[model samples]
Target: MRKSKLMVFIISVVVMSLLMVWDMPKVFDNINLGLDLQGGFEIVYEVSPLDGKSEIPEMSAVSKSISKRIDVLGVNEPSIMIEGENRIRVQLAGVQDQDQARRILSSTANMSFRDVNDNLLMDATVIKEGGATLAFQNGIPVVSLKIADQDKFYEVTKELATRGEGKNLIVTWLDFEEGVDSYAKEMEKVAKGEEPAYVSAASVREGINGDAVISGNFTDESARELADLINSGSLPVKMNELYSNVVSAELGEGAYEKTMIAGIIGYIAVVIFMIAMYRLPGVISAFMLFIYLWAVLKVYNLMGGVFTLPGIAALVMGAGMTVDANVITFERIKDELYKGRSVKKAFEEGSQMAFSSIFDSQFTTLIAALVMYWLGTGSVKGFATMLMITIVGTLLITVQVVKFLLGLLVSSGWLDNKKTWFGVSAKHLPDVAKGEERKYFGKFHNVDFMAIFKKVSLLPVAILVIAVAMGVFNSVSGNGFLNLGIDFASGTKITVQSDAPLTVDAIEDKFEEFGYQVSRVQLSGDNNEMASVSIKEVIETEDMYELKEALEAEYGYEPSDSVVTPVVGRELVRNALMACAVAWVAMLAYISFRFKFDYAISCIITLMHDVLLILAIYAIFRIEVESTLVAVVLSIIGYSINSSIVTFDRVREILDGKENAKNPKEYYKTVVNEALRNTGERSLITTITTALPLIALIFLGSPSITGFNTSMLVGILAGAFSSLFLAAPIWYTFRVNKKPTQKKQKNVKKLDEPTEINVPGINS
Candidate 1:
């Protein structure tokens, strides 16, 4: 049986290795890249009906029309999604001319016919859906339209024909805005030697017409585009850009490279830490972490998910989560080994005992990830997506695959007596045959966590109070509670890169040259060659074009820009609050179900503490509060509960054994302290592993994600502190202070008789 188990383990390793090597490259190749990663733009437009009385156009039709219009630009893999009742989101990746792309996309291809008097006769309603075709009339390219109504066209032609000489003309106009554009105005511009606004004007020889030919001095490319726009059904609704994020290719490539390097470095550090700390089990988890990543990437690619900067951050966080699970299990096994149990017996009992803690932690985090996905937009949603994938992947790989591999190794009988292989030292092991008491061999085994809980808990509370006071002060002083970024506040942000170092004054002077003053400017990059400029007022579309051109000419590269309207900013703020609230409620309910209400309340308080602490830091430090901060808070809410749950799981196990203790109050405190001492090392190790990659990101990753990494790093430390010192103590207080019912007293008295209780966990 030992030989067979060994052979099965070897075969499984070989199979997994083969699969990973074969599919890794293909998985990366298949995954989609978001605009932030690949360089392009994403815009959400609020659509309104063209005519006031008309109902909003079907979103599907609008999306389809936009898709067809995108094809005219020859873009690859454009994403057009209809959001809500009247908003359409268009994401175009790898488009060079953002200004032109935006213009083409939102252009109302409302073709119209007018008499010489410039009075409208017929609109685009007369044209068929797919009837417009490119043609040549006497060597000049033209757009031929198959009229849907022959009679209306004939009547328009007849009116034009009745007007004599040059006045007997049918004027064709494209994108004629009501109360703004007219054929007479366009002809007046032509007379003044400026370009005509109308597309063409042709003499109407007769009133007989089934089709219409629009002839302007059109180039082949221009004619084809005009025909394509007409053929692609006109947008029945007007589109107004509410939010847009545009990135330059140079910026995208730089961000992707820097973030990837940071991620690889972080992953390497985590793997090394795991192997060194957990010994042989660490090696198994190390190997499994590789499999975990490959599996997550494979699943994400299959789901057609786009990889973003935040998504990469989530992947790193997921690695931390997986490490936490492995550490928890390994710690349990070591505890069992400390009791002088055989390796196989220890592994069996430890795996079973660690199941509840792992499940509760991962599930609570899963709840937060789901809420973020539902309410977050843009990169926040991407972060949530990758987080969800990682959670599911970590749970499956760590719980099932890691256990199975470890099981095979244990069952092979090769590791039967070597407790040290699982990081247990011989000196720490008790002599079970001699009836010695089981001991904790962890580093914090001597520290009474409850003794110092009051002092340490005061720290977070004071910080929270300071944060609130700062918020109130800021509000009174007219500075907002937190510094809001473009994602949560309406503004224009432009990021420009130059070959030469840039200064705030230089950039301000440049903006002044364009007749505008920037609200604020900050320089980054190793040589200060990049500048982020913000404007309180959203720049008009025409002004943005001129600014983009002037900046590109000066910097030798086009600057990336983001414009957010007040409407989108308000919506984003609401959604972020909603995401956080829903995450809290969901985690509270789940923790309550898995444990008890007191445990749930304590965990929730700890989570809120971590979130508020981070917010307070942000408020005091004046960090830009943006959508990414939402991802950070929710992630902390999900993850901070882990240590609390692990400790509480231990408390429950210890309490079950002392259910009928003589002094229930003193025993409750004792159990919590014991649980803390027992689980303290694993919790610290989990945070360290998690922090390793986040630290790398903070120092080495793109400047764009620096805020995200820093916030997460702060939350991680706060979470570990609160879970260790605050949550357990809070739970202890709740349990000891509550009065027990009469039935419980009787039960305690009944079980008071000296008898053994064999609890079904490791310590039991």
Candidate 2:
């Protein structure tokens, strides 16, 4: 090995290590955590015009109002997005009280000042937006209000000041709803289920301008809470909370640590495997992998994406993909060396030839992810975002940067001494030829893909058949078509954190003792100290309130909860189904545009097969199909189409070579055969290499995203199998009878004489 190349590599490693320790963490800390990873509630509220109005209110003004409210609430990081024309989505991370948050967000805190005679003097229109704060007056607590309109406020105060000293007083009231400002009316409202709180009243001995501080009977906490709510500004329209969820801190922290561990372990395993497989090229791949991770995280920080548990799963998935790209490039290099090319020539041409397949594969996945991001919401959006970033980053770091660095080593003469460092044995090189070509990489590659395809295709079909029966059974068993999670189904779920570990039986017993039937029970957090207990029936808000109080008081358990109303539940299910379809069709269109129509048609069929088979598995197992399920299904589609695209790209390259040849060797069958042989190793290598990190996530990562990881795993394996055997064979069946033009033999070398090249289904 050349000392220069070795030193360069050593220096790069040291610099990356230093950057990882000192810079990456600092950059990553800038990444925001989602509600599921921090403790808080995410709610989507539908705003409506007043009861007598017929038109919808403007959403931009509503969003601004809610944003100011969240800022005043002192939330760590709150996100407010306007949907369509009149809906608002608010996500508050690290806020504990869900009930209080809902009240504060939806309540119209209409501040009013009335004279002591119970006559209204001024309304909230005169106050500046976000101009309320808790101040001190004469060493006592007071609520301060800033007036935006000096003339209006002064006119009101001047009238009040002219009254006798005993009657000249301004009383402040924060109305929870409209039309109630007096103490009597507020008391009457309080007699019902709701009430407006009285803030403070002050003497208006003189006209005031700019700001007014009212000192009264007030405590520090109450004064501050009222000030914050008042500063939030009143909503112009009524906000009805439609969907909401609160995540517990214990669960969030546990998921955080477990996912990080899964990432580190999975990454280390991938590094070890790469070095074992590709030697020096593997080391270069590892460096590029490091850089890829660093770059993606930095970009994520810059994009201001909120990191969720599912997003962590996406990042792990991304790492596996980076490994896949590295594997593809290195495998091509090995193929070149096996054909007797020198190290430098192999590296050069191999990277060049590998680009087409990689581009097609990555491009298909990117298209699907884009569709997912566009249609998905909340954490699903976050996952799709990371998926896109990962794909782009893989193309940059794994493909472009790895090749550049490996070329440096090759050019510096570090790789000139032996083929072992490049994972190519001396016997495989052409110079040692005992002549007649052999299987690729010392592995048997002469399987009859068409024949095997006909036989093996039935497995997924059979799985689909079973899946169909299972789905029918599930549908008939009073459970709709799938065991849907609360995210897509109507129910009340309470996630509880106790000082002690919770067992299913114990949880069931507790609910049973309380005369509440537990529909489902799941455990999370370290040592199983947390449990999510759900009830399928629609429990009243009052009942849920009593239950929460009882559980908290008696068991000292802190429970975060979610409720999906029937209307929203129906909408979720419909949208998720629609998203799955849209993702499939979008991929088909992109593939069709990029390649030929036949390849696109066959790829979508195999893609559908993969999706149906996964659904069948979920049905048989009664897995919950929730919002994240949509993300998982799309990711699988992405992966399935990706594998199919790789095979087709190879087929196209070969067909083009055949057409340009002076003499075409055989025709479509031979072309298809060679294409499959060339790509089968690349397919298998990618599948196995990508599965490494997922395996870690399945075992050691957050339990929440285990479904997503498992789905991707199944799809990847199925994709690799179908891409090599099914997709190509099916496409070949479409064009099997087409005749090729006669031409002279060109330089393209076919693999060693096949035991049997032509099969029954292909140009028999």
Candidate 3:
């Protein structure tokens, strides 16, 4: 209450100036562009070679080979990696034409050469069928072959020998750059009757098995083609494309525009509502809120945080929460004024009283955001990032920025005691009659502290037990953790827009026939204008074309484009884990610096609980552990922390009031109860506001978005519970010690009077 106006103004200016200097344009440029925003093609390829006969090692080898081939294609920032057991995802950025991409990608490069008149030469089948002999002569492995037409074979062999002079025939083991290469000189020396060479035509191996190995000047591409040809061979297992579509970057840009516009409009509306409802205090609060928004954007820009559609939505949601602290403070001030307290006394008491509520509410939100960042990936992570930033930004703006501004305004007599802003006047308000404060149930009872501690600890212990039990059951049941989405696990994703409605099951069945492990299929696009099918493995370009054709034939609608793929696998998982860990640690550091160590510890503990609980549920329910899960977990962390912080702020206030006190048990208890009681309504309101949009998203969003929503819904609810039950109780246990005193006895007596405890319209 005794804050310096000059100091407050200087701090605000300094913070604002710093934020402005940190690339304001870049910050407001819109959310970070996703793959969808940047034009690209994503394709999922199934790496199983002919039926299910391939071994894990063989499949792994094939995956490596295919990845090398895609890398050779030189797509910008291309992502080509394995996913799950036998899946490969390839993402090509800035690919405008799907047909060209498909053509390049689908052309099975089975590079093989034949005689001039099309006579049968060495092929991949020779090794598999006839078991060609390999012998070491002169310390060199000699691969010998026998052909049906010896004369024609000799001519081809001689040509190869002659061409071998200075060049080496590089037989890429599987066409990779690291494959084996043999010098043509060695073959020439043996063919020309010089002496036994590294490779001899002595017919040491026999049988016309349908092919022969050719080695020579094969550049990287040619080598790869040959390897692919040999590895794939000619097979009857043809691929049929299930669906494909071209996603226009224009759509993403449009979405970005609409989201920005909606956010601005919504923010403006909230500001207007606050000003009209609270008058001068509302105006000040609104200004502080604006500052909060600016700080969030600045921080986001400074940190290079990417904004997405969901991120934009989160920003809008955060805007609502940003003013919550101010509202609590203003309401308390009004209550004090109604009790006939002097303007200065009302302002002081109200701000002090509001701390608990504000901190609690914000802490809950912070916790939820943290959990989301931990468990989410991709766009969901983006949302979580924004939510977390906004919560922290709000704390700074509301607690420091707004509180200081309000103090300055009151001190400067800008808001006098006489003038009426909303309704009640300073003179007309009721006098503060002395009364007994209400006593909570069992507050004065001489209960055993140790017994209570044991009883309370049981809840967290039970949760831990349940979590462990579920984890064990999940491991034994063979229903591994959530089946991650493509954003995390990687695979093939195809979105098809049609004029008519289509069933997900029908499309899934069609894809299954094409030998695709169709994991998920759902209606996408506004008004069900499109259907998206995601599979466990990527589809080759040729297979994509085939699938598109099949769709056209069966569904009477041709796909507008070939499928696009994104890389998924170990690399993605590793990166996601690293990013989430970094975010969590960074959040902890920031919170520790902003608040006390105990508060930071409490926040982290609550966050961990929320995250673990979410994971436990996911493991229990067998939800797919995709990138969206990360988003949910991070969101939970942010929300839970927001609630905890509110309570801590109240504790700080109580500590400030009784600096000389030996024990702070009474202070902590009052703070906790007051914080929870005051902020309960706002907490419910904020939750509802956030929940409504998510509920809509669950019903209307794309499969990916719906998954994100589901995770968020669970996280939000868990975060709310953790804030009230877990965070506060834990904080009380850590900070307060039960001790009997005469002051406590006096307080208990004061609490027994009904007239002292009840505030009119409070329960109402």
Candidate 4:
């Protein structure tokens, strides 16, 4: 502990902070943004098996083919994903010509050639893929096509040339359907417009092969257009629209700006609270907090991770976690200082004590993050990936780097007797025997949490039962398990644009008059100039335009609609359920390995309770359950585990350290109660710190994100409650008080009384 090391640590932190700010703009510019954050459209298309074909086209090949076609739109950084077996999801960001993009994407573009007698000849198969090139033929703009098989083309041309009875011609059709093949008829359904799909029919005086030119009064621009279309090739399989969404640039830009402001405000609020609560140590944490954000973003950029709205929220929330880690260490040090220990000695002991708690909390959350990455999709997947990366950054930055800096200051001996620096007032110090003194934040040390739980346990249990009943009734009533949002039910969502204010009632009335059952109506925009109307029943493409026009004519509102087919909706529901189950099991298994089966089961039960409570609230309130609900549920799992891990960590640490141990039945309650009390401050502060960022999201984020934030807020509260009152008490009951019938079912011998076993993580 020397002054030289302290100076070095201070210099390193300052320089890193300065460099981070200096390079932040460059990192921001390089960062990738998801369609939701960057204003674009995403579509999930199901590639149905072509007529007469028993099997569907290869999904990977289909994705690649679609990717090549999408590249023609010239949208930067388009993403193409193959989902399951027959679906391909395409996302194009910052695309303005949505109509053109849609048309080009779904078009069959199945080109063919025929003779004057309407006799079938060679089609695109005879032409090499991507072989079309613009050319000048006879001083006119023309499209050149290279033959894939010279012999087949020569034979066709020879046949045309021999038909010299004033009939020596070949015809070209962009979307040719002779109606012979049923698959061709299917293509007929997808290819039709005001502009003819035909390019030209030319007379052949002599037989030719290899390469030929087609000119049909096409200008230079039209020639290039034809060349590009031909080069992009044709769809290998018919793409059925499963789901599609279009977001305006204005909406995305506004969300980005507002979310940024909210994050900054939340960050400042947390920093101020930290400083006020812990004084100098809080200042040290704030400096490291700056570096935490900077380092996470820098790594995120390097990893080519896309930043979405939820992803941004994860970063802000991660800052809170970083602060929580710092606080845990700082609080322990303050406790030591109150016991009359020197600042240097306190730092040494406190840091070691805090390590186990920090490790358990971070790793449990990391399990959730990893599960999400493996199971989640689209922007949800992005959020999971970002969370995983941030967890690592938090551990390295706060757990390691912050510790190093704080230790350097302690080593320098500059903080020898500065008890006040850690928020320990002279009056707060205990007068007990030296080293035996203890200080508590509040005088609830003897409050029997278990006794209170015995009384209030009925609240959560009753609410849960009611929630399950409501879900059953709702499902049986045909609405769904919950009032599923359009995201979960495949249907059309029409985005109506108007400057005039409108009521949801009036909109619903209009839709009802049109024989449409309105599921829900959402208003957005700065002045509520947009109404997104959801229709549960699937509507035909032909009727979509008619409906849009009718609504516009009646209300002077221009409506653009996006559709999600029931197929994608079903898949989403399945995956969401699986993700929740897998995440919970993963956390349980991890805890079992780290601690014991008793703690694992208890933690899992608490986590499940928190999610059930969230679901119950959503159902009772008739809130829309969608993909974001999945995010909220999984996040609660993480938070719930985090709290339990911290508490259990302390429990294990204390029990292991006890040299004079008694029978488990004799001291179980005393030990368990002590563990919970020790970690009570950390659990409470961590929730508050993390919840602050989520509160910002609820108030300042985009309207689209309101449901997500509400779920998150509820989750934080539920996690805090369950971890404090439910987890340990429940575990104690499981370990110490199993009835005879329960023992028979569990296949364990009945015990005279529950006693602590010498398990690996249990006082081993």
Candidate 5:
């Protein structure tokens, strides 16, 4: 049986290895990269009625129209999303003709027929779907349209026929600019020796209405384009560009390469740390960690998901979480070995004992990820997706596979006397045969946590208060509490890259020469050859094109630009708040259902403390707060809850032995203090593992995500502090002060009988 177990372990490892080698490369190649990765353009349009008083068209119809236009552009997998009630966001990745794409996207295509008096006679409502086709008439290319309403066309022709021969001209106009284009205006322009705005004009002879031909001074290409545009259907409402982001392919490639390097560095550091700390079990964990990462990316590829910059960050964060679960189980196994259990028995009991905490942590984090996915949009949704995939992957691969491999190794009877292999020393072991009690195993085991909680608790509160005061003062002084990024502040950010080194003053001078004021300039890239300049004003489309041309002339290549309007900025703020609030409420409900109300309260308070501390740091340090801050806060909420739940689980376990003790309040203190002591190392280790990727990202990753990584690093440190010092103490305050009910007393007495405590584990 032992041989079979060993063989099965070997086979599993071999299978995982084979699968990774065969499909991992394919997964990387097939995964769709978002606009932020590949070079492309994204724009948000505010939809409004053509006339001032008409009701806005349905969002579905508008998106369908936009989708049709994108089809003409030949863009692969364009993303069109409706934001709020009146905005549509279109993302086209890897589009080459960005200028033409933007022009085609915003074109109204509102074809019209008017008489010499500039009176409207017919409109695009007569054209059938896909009815327009390019054709030849008398060796001249023209657009042919199958009119949906033949009777209306006949009436219009009959009315025009009543006018005099030379004056009875039916003028056809394409994209009739409201308040701008008219027959009189065109005639005036014609008289001034300029081109007319109308496409074509025809004299009405009879009321023939089966089909209509729009003949113009057209080449084959122009005629084909006009036919395609007509077939695509005119947008029911006018669209105003409110936000846009255009990235250069070179910048995207640089970002992807740098971020991947950072992630690899972080992953390696985490693996080395785990092996150094846990010995053999750490080796198994590191192996499973590789499998875990493969499974996540492979699954993402299978799902046909788009990979983005934030998605990469999510993957790095998942590595941290994967290591965290392993550390918890390994720590538990070491604790079991210290109690004089055999290697096999310690492996079994530790796996069982660690199950509840790991499950609780995973479950709570799942809640936060789900909330983020439900309420998030754009790249935020992408981050949430990667996070969810990692969580699911950890449960299926990290938790189960690691435990199985380690179980097989221990049960083979080859390491029966090798407890040191599991990282337990002879000096720390207690002999069960001699009736020596097992002392706590952590370095902090001898420290009195409750004795210092009173003082340490004050420090966070004081810091939070000062942070709030600073926020108020900053707000009152006309600057926002936190340094808002372009994502939240609604501005234009231009990224200019040069082969030679560039400075802020040089970039500022260039902008000044262009007659535009620069708000701020940040330098990045290895040699500081790239500069990101922010402008408070949203540059118009024509002006942006001119600026891009000028910068390209000055620099070597055209730069990337992102512009956001005030409307989208406001919407982002609202959605971010909603995402955070929904996450907190959802977590509170989940914890309350799994544990108790008081425990739920304590966990939530600690989570709030973590967020406040992170915000405080950002506000005090003037870190630019962007839309990704929502992601950071939500992620920290998940991380902090994991720690809080683990500690609470320990408190519950220790309290199981307190049924017969007098002075229950003092016992509560001991239970809480002991819980902190027991879980302190796990908390610290989790933070370190999680922070590894973030620190690497801050120093070595893409500048696009540097602020995001920095914010996450601060939140992680704050989460660890709250988990160890604040969470359980708050719970202790609630528990020690509450009076026990008769029913609760009965339950406690029922648990008094010595029976097997069924620890929820894989074996169970």
Candidate 6:
């Protein structure tokens, strides 16, 4: 025991030291700020052909084109990706001037050369479709254009002439391509009143079909546009801007302040609760919890974790888990007290008894966290990573710091009297008041074990198995293992607020006339005054203007506000999942290395069950799986495993006791029952307490956080259930054999008499 205590001390000190030295504060300081926390431009575009055939593939192409254009615009960390199948959501970070971003994004890069008779000479299509050879030799630009099919060329050229001139005559091109300067120079000569003459040039390309060398004096913009046009062929789809907004950082400031205040209040409340519950021991536990918080923060900072609103919530949740460990330990002390043990003996035995449970619970929560971190994308993964880190920190503080301090207090005679402080009296000690061990904790020897263990409860097992099977079905059925949000798939989101109520069907008809395939249009605002129109394609600037005009024409009033754009795409989704998965797997492997294999296995199983159950619930409810779901899963995983570790620690204690005459099955049952008795109230209370704020968020928070809260509510329930029912039961089945081991037999010595100790307390 001494050696174990010393080992824990050494490990904690080393870990904490390393964390501090790594400058966690600086690391967290550099984390990427989210769009809400930082000022940025958000543009929603509808991508569809003027003909409006849904044009999903065409919309994807337009999104890519626009993204490339934005990239060339040099907006810092531009988030230009496809949303759903129709919209393109573009976010430009650090873009303070919304108008500038809009102008840059909206400016159509259309380039063309027209003849004096208003005939189309060349356009983006001509450059893209034409087999052109480009080379720069001795400072002279040369482009050999080959027109294999002249019939299609004439039709394209005729269409270009009808599109207008002056600003419209500009030739659009991709950036940094070969032969654009040469083409521009040739066009410049024609613009300079040169005679219309056909020049047959075969030196540029020997055996090419029909070749023309375009050379003229061209400006940098014109040349670049020409290059861009050549590189990116004409977009098959036209963009209609459905929505645009430049959300300032100010919106997040209030949320940040509220979160901070709430966190502080929550921290204080948890500490008070802990201290009030267990008196001196509780005080020590509270102190350790504070340290745990500090350590977790430091680690988060050191690891460069960005503290978003969801991240802050995760921190609070982690604090609750930290308090949970103390609750387990204190309850164990109460149990020991009920066993007619001395204060010192109760303290030692309780702490010892609580260790395995705490470890198991935490380990399981960590596993779930890992899965969240594994499968989750974006903010979800971020939350999971932080929660996992804090869980580790909490374990260290609980098992080592809290335990050590409590031991020191008892060893130094600080807690010699049971009725010393905080209104706790001898009556509060369950052991002294009862004068015997409780039925659950009393030693079981020479019992008819076969008779008692004859029947196995298959009901719980059946339910669990069914749940697992359902989860597997969901995984294969394409409802998905995790809910994927619009942030990953490209789509359009149009928020329209009008003075009067409007049905989704009415709005759908208006958009459908404009050739947009409306997917799911739902009325969103209170009093049915606002409508959220989700389309298969992004709505562009022209689309928005037309929609506004149509709305005014139909309802005699335009929408007071509106924003439309595409969702995120596969790339960002892939990255988010990778980040989460890596975090989870790493944590799992780490836990396995740090603890025993059985401990690791229990954690993983509990986590899997929690995740699967959450998925099943979501599937049953038919909630769209999105990024927020990922955050919920991560948070729940941490919470659930934290509970499992607590139970496992208690089981370890019972098994480690001197009077372990029961077989593994009996020992497991005793531990499971004890764990429930010890942590049942704490788990329930903590989960309820933690869930309250989330519930509040669900009712009052913004749309962004609503998803997160919903996920948390479901995940928390699933996590708690799995921790209590699945973690230990599965662990016992796998690790503990049907028969008692030699080590167990040796540990149970048939004592003739009970040992006694004398202290200053009146009871003996």
Which one is best on TM-score?
A: 1
lDDT for model 5: 0.82
Q: Write the per-residue lDDT of candidate 2 for residues 1-764, one digit (tens) a residue.
A: 47877688667667877877788877767878887666678889988885567876678877887887787668866788775466678989888788778878887787778765566778888888777788887778887878899898988888888989767878786653345446666556658956346666567888886688766667887678778887777777788888887777767777777877887788788888889888988887877787888889899988877887657657766776777777778888898888777788888888898888888888888877776678766555677899999999988767877776777678777676567788877665666345645434445367667668778878887887777787788678777677776666678888877777778998888777768877778678877888878777667878778877877875697466678665555554465566667877877787788887778888888887777777877877887766665556666676667777878988888777445244343466677787788778767777777788788878988885577678767766766777777888888876654465478878977778766667888967
Per-model C-alpha lDDT, please?
Answer: 0.82, 0.75, 0.57, 0.77, 0.82, 0.58
User: What's the C-alpha lDDT at position 489 in model 4?
Assistant: 69
For candidate 1, the clash count comes to 0
Question: Which stretches of model 4 miss by more than 4 angstroms?
Answer: 48-58, 96-99, 107-110, 116-119, 125-129, 133-155, 161-169, 174-225, 431-436, 439-443, 472-478, 499-513, 551-558, 657-666, 738-764
**Cα lDDT tens digits for candidate 4, 650-705:** 76776784532335544667767777777777777778788877788779877766
TM-score, cand. 1 vs. native? 0.90
Ranking by lDDT: 5, 1, 4, 2, 6, 3
| Weakest 10 consecutive residues of candidate 4 by summed lDDT | 181-190
Model 5: how far is 416 from its true place, Å? Answer: 2.2
**Which rank order by TM-score, best down to worst?**
1, 5, 4, 2, 6, 3
521 in model 3: Cα distance from truth in Å?
Answer: 2.2
Candidate 6 lDDT over residue span 467-490, tens digit each: 556556778996454344444445
Model 5: ten consecutive residues of lowest lDDT = 742-751
Q: Per-candidate TM vs. native?
A: 0.90, 0.87, 0.55, 0.87, 0.87, 0.56
How displaced is residue 703 in candidate 2, in Å?
3.4
Better of 4 and 6 by lDDT: 4
